[model samples]
Target: MVLFVVAKEETLQKPMYLLLCILAVTEIGGTTCIMPKALCIFWFGFKGITVDGCLTQMFFLYLFAVTHSAVLVIMAFDRYVAICDPLRYTTILSNARIAKLGLVGLIQAVLLILPLSLLLRKLPLCANPVILHTYCEHIAVVKISLGDTRVNRMYGLVITVVNIGLHLTLIGLSYGLIIRAVLRISSKKAHQKALNTCTAHICVMLMSYTPFLFTALTQRFGQDNAAHVHILLANLHLLVPPMLNPIIYGIKTKELREKTAKDKDKGSNDKAELLSHTYSDPAGA
Candidate 1:
């Protein structure tokens, strides 16, 4: 649906839609990195993965996760500009600027996760090779390492603080400004409309981050929970946002809904034309 919007809708060629497209693609990438292996484990009983393969999966899992979070931060900024400074939004968040922001997010996610792979490569696995979860995760893999993981832990902390902490703070601050701006508007209808515009994004943010926050907190502090519970929340955090983001946006955002409807009508007309051409007589009967 997002791809369709990008391809067909000329009006949606703005930065907001471009960011949404990137986010949709990123979400797909993130979930694909883990879900296939998870399904194989469930259906085919193919649970074992090579160490190098595990590391690769871990890299992509964190890469996409970090990228998605960064994208959300960008989105928060986008919303802030759109709502708080509507007149300057076009000039501020031009296509080139949006592209740069997207590139930065991609690079940041890659650079942050790159060190994890390098650190994992250095660690000697002396514990049981079996990974309890459905897919490879950095902390899970690090826990089984025999060598000193102080540096790995420290780097992990830094990564979490930078990626999650910084992004969340920025998002919160963006929303804070957005709220302040919204309140300044004297028209209640405009205020409501502006808030409505942000609803899908807020939902997507909550869906994407809340479960991950829970899982991370549990992993760091709540050790008494069952392994299955941890795995379940992890899977939810990785999978649910991707699955729900489009749905939430489609339902909540008027433009997306209208575009989808237009696409459907266009598809139907194209199908009808194809049928007419297929059944029409060669002799112009």
Candidate 2:
């Protein structure tokens, strides 16, 4: 969070700071949205998962899931702007415009997730009372449904393909354009820097999103080990990005070093003033 705030300060001239704030908020929302459901899942077994409790968890979890995906999509767009449209990047992604788009994304995510919440609520929990994964994932919760789940399953599959697969494709396409644009630059230093920036974004995105598709795909075909792998991946999906994003972003941008230097200078001056005041006091002398 501090890194984000510092980035906001360093990139004050660009619209990148605003994007950073949006990404920071989405990350917080995405990672915490499932906490209530996860607490209940761990505290009481699936049998204890009441109808209302399950629905409530499902709602927020779904909201965060969609929001998380949308934030990632927005990040890709940010990259596109930085790489392909550098000339008008500030004007194109003005603070007001970025905020409006973010608001739209948040609303769309809520609208998308709400219907899933309602759909899942209508289904009855069957006699079998085990959720295979550590968290309250939609598939894990639905696997034990007494009523027909074909509709839910189909919808889930469609969403996964669209949200994960399609989004990834678009990100790839954006990078392709970015790469092409960078190559057109004759300056070797400039080209390498551009590539480096895109590389960091790609690495972070792969780490964040690949395990998700793996877990989702494995759940359909794999056996006992699949559940454990999915759980591990889910935890990784939660843990790794938040841990790495700031570091990767800081290094990629080169702004953290500048901010750190400024902070250290400020601290030294503050310390010098304190020492001067201490010695000036009669009691101290």
Candidate 3:
């Protein structure tokens, strides 16, 4: 639905919409990486996955996750430009530039996560082959490995800290500036309007990161935590954002709502016209 709307609607050809389209694709890709296998395990009792296959799945899962985070950072920048610098927003975030940003996000994720898979390949798994979680996760895979995982752990920590920290920092900075700019407006209506534009993105960003943060922290620090809780949070971290993003944005964004309403009205009119024509020609038939 998001792809169709963004592609067909000329009014949605701006950088904000382009970013949204990219985000939609990222969400779909991220969920696709894990959901099918998860459903297979749940419904068909097919839980066994080979080491190489698990690694592959983990790679794509983290790749999509990292890319999603990077995309959120880009979105923060988008909102920042839209709110803090309205006149120069177009100049700074042109279509080509937005496309480039999307590409960069994907590329960065691949580069950062590719090494983890390579490291996984080196680890010798002597423990039970069964993964506790629904899908293959990097930490879970590494934890089960018997080989020296010092390098993998160090690298994983670095990547997590750097990737998540950088994204959060940039988003925070962008929102800080946006808030400052928004507060400068004397009119309460203008202030509300400007903040309203950012509200959806803010919700999305929080939704995207909060679950993962809790899960990661708990996995690392909480020694007495339940396995089911960890698994649940991990799955939710992957599934919730993709499923809810379109609905949230559609409800929060006026343009999307208007477009949806227009499409519905057009369909109704077409159906009515077809019914009228059919009735009118009944005698001829």
Candidate 4:
């Protein structure tokens, strides 16, 4: 829905909305990587995944996750540009530039995760391997495998620190700068307006990252017997942002909200007209 609305709505073709569309795609991919199998396990108790399947799941899960983190940082940058330098926002965040950033983020995810996947592939599994959790998470899979996993654990730790830590730092810096810029505005209305623009973004970032970092830490350090707690945290990290981002954006953004309302009205009018015609002229095809 976000992608379609952004593509068709002329007013929503700005860099921010474009980023939202990319974020939406990442959310879809991230959820797709885990939701089906997790649900099947919970509902039908069918917990089966081959070695190849587990590797594939691990690759995609982190790929989308890393990509999602990058997008959040970029969105913070977007807000920074819009707030700190309104006059040059377009020149600074041109469509081509945003595309380049998205491409770089995807390449970064591949570079970081592909080697880890290869390392995971070399680990030996038992005759009947069972991940102590719902899905074949990278950490869970590594826990269940035999042989030295120090390299895999080290690589994952480095990736998490570099990817999640760096992104969080950058986002924090962007917001700090944004706050400074907002404060510099003299008029009361202007300050509030600038802050208002960032409200939805800050909320979304909190929703995206808090559970994510907690889940990552839990996967690495939590008690072995608390697998269920870890599983719930992981699902919340993967699932919540995607569910709420659209709602937050739609309610907070004037242009998107109005566009959706217009479309809804148009659809209702079309439906009513079709029904009226059918009732008035039943024999007419």
Candidate 5:
């Protein structure tokens, strides 16, 4: 909400602000669309899939999947700018540049997940169709398909490799640079602050990525109530980070706190201006 308002005005020139907005929007989509669909499928079961509904759910799942993955990539880049190129960080991660990266991420996500629909669409639903967890996840949904899921399995393998491999590569690179930067900082305070920032990001990444990887591996290896564990972890992966991000940033970063204060000031000023303008005519005279 604050990001939306900050982005609306011209004064907020911070690159990180735009990054925050991108993160917020992406997480909102993940939480609202992906989480709910997964939970609904797990809890209530699918409501008689029409040919259209299946396709629609699949599309939304695709959208959520891509956006979530892309957002992680975007964040890795953001960290890179902040740590690796602090001097040119503003120019490197300008609003336009961030917007472009975000678009590319979104596009990449969409393209990557498009195959899932094609691969899994025609496969027959299983007999004992109970999603172990609270969501209709890509893998869980696919697990029960009676048809030859070799193609689906292959595509899933590709997605797992690409998504995990790419995002982890970028994140690893960013943190490598970040660690160097932190080490170079003479001030203990500065080093601690840098470590603290990345700590939240690292925690989020662990929570988000670990379950997906575990689930994928377990499925391939003939796992058990691991599905139930995977489902619980999956929900936590989606829910915990998003809920934590704003709170952590708000509490830890002085810049964000100041910006929030300034935003409040700006709001008060705007309300004052409106009141003055409204009564500034003959009534005031």
Candidate 6:
């Protein structure tokens, strides 16, 4: 619906909405990357993926995740400009620029994550490997690789920190600036409005990152934590945000909400008209 509405509604063809469309695409792709094989394991008899298959799946999984986070960081930048520098928001984040930023993010994800897959691909694996986790993660691949994995391990750690750390740092800075700007607004109504615009994004950012953070911390520090607990948290972080973002933005965004209402009304009218036509045509009835 986000993609559809953005494509159909000319009023929504702006930078923010375009980013939302990219996010929507990532959400769909991310879920698709993780769910099918998982469901197959649950429903059909459990089987395993081959080395190349795992690499491919790992590539897509990280690609979507890394890209999603990058886009969120970009969205934070959007919100910052809108709140902190409203006058120049249009000039700063032109549609073409946002598209380029999105492309850069995607290319960055590919460049950053492709090596991990390739690193794993080049390494030898056990004759019949089985990962403890439900999905094929990069670390899991490294864990199973039979060759010396010092480089893979170090590279993985560095990239994980760099990518996630950089994304978090930028998003935090953007929001901090946004808050300062909102606070500077004289009118209470304007302050509240600025804050309200940020509410959806704050919710989205928290939802997207909190579980993952908790899971990462638990895996790193919690010696007594259950394996299944980590697995569940990891999966939920991927699944829940994509499922909720559409609902969140739909309710919170004024233009999107108005568009949804209008679309609903239009649908109802069309249904009523079709019913009327069918009833009036006695032969058709």
Error of 3 at 37 (Å): 0.8
lDDT of candidate 1 at residue 250, scale 0 to 100: 83
How many clashes in each structure?
Answer: 0, 0, 0, 0, 5, 0
**Candidate that beats the other on TM-score, 5 or 6, i.e. the better one:** 6
Which candidate, 3 or 4, has the higher TM-score?
4
Model 1 worst lDDT window (10 residues):
276-285
Model 6 lDDT at residue 269: 100
* Tens digits of lDDT, candidate 3, 1-285: 878887888998888888888888888888898989999999999988998889889898888889889989999998998888789988999999989998999999999999999998988897667677898887788778888999998898899899999999999999899999988999999999999998899888878888888888887777698989889988888888788888989999999888978887998999999888888897844
Which lDDT tens digits does candidate 5 get at residues 1-285? 557555665666566666667767777776776655555666886544443455556567557666766777677778767776778877777778877887888888778877787777788876656544455567777776789888887887898798879888987887888888788889999887777766656666776677667656766664665556666666766678778777666666566677787788999999999888878877665
Could you tell me how far off, in angstroms, the CA of residue 217 lies in candidate 1 after the best superposition? 1.2
Q: What TM-score fits each model?
A: 0.93, 0.83, 0.95, 0.96, 0.77, 0.94
Off by over 4 Å in 3: 283-285
The predicted structure with the larger lDDT, 4 or 6, is 4
Model 6 global lDDT (CA atoms, 0 to 1): 0.87
Computed on alpha carbons, the lDDT of every model, listed in order, comes to 0.88, 0.72, 0.88, 0.89, 0.71, 0.87
What overall lDDT, based on C-alpha atoms, would model 1 receive against the true structure? 0.88
Q: Candidate 1, clashing residue pairs?
A: none
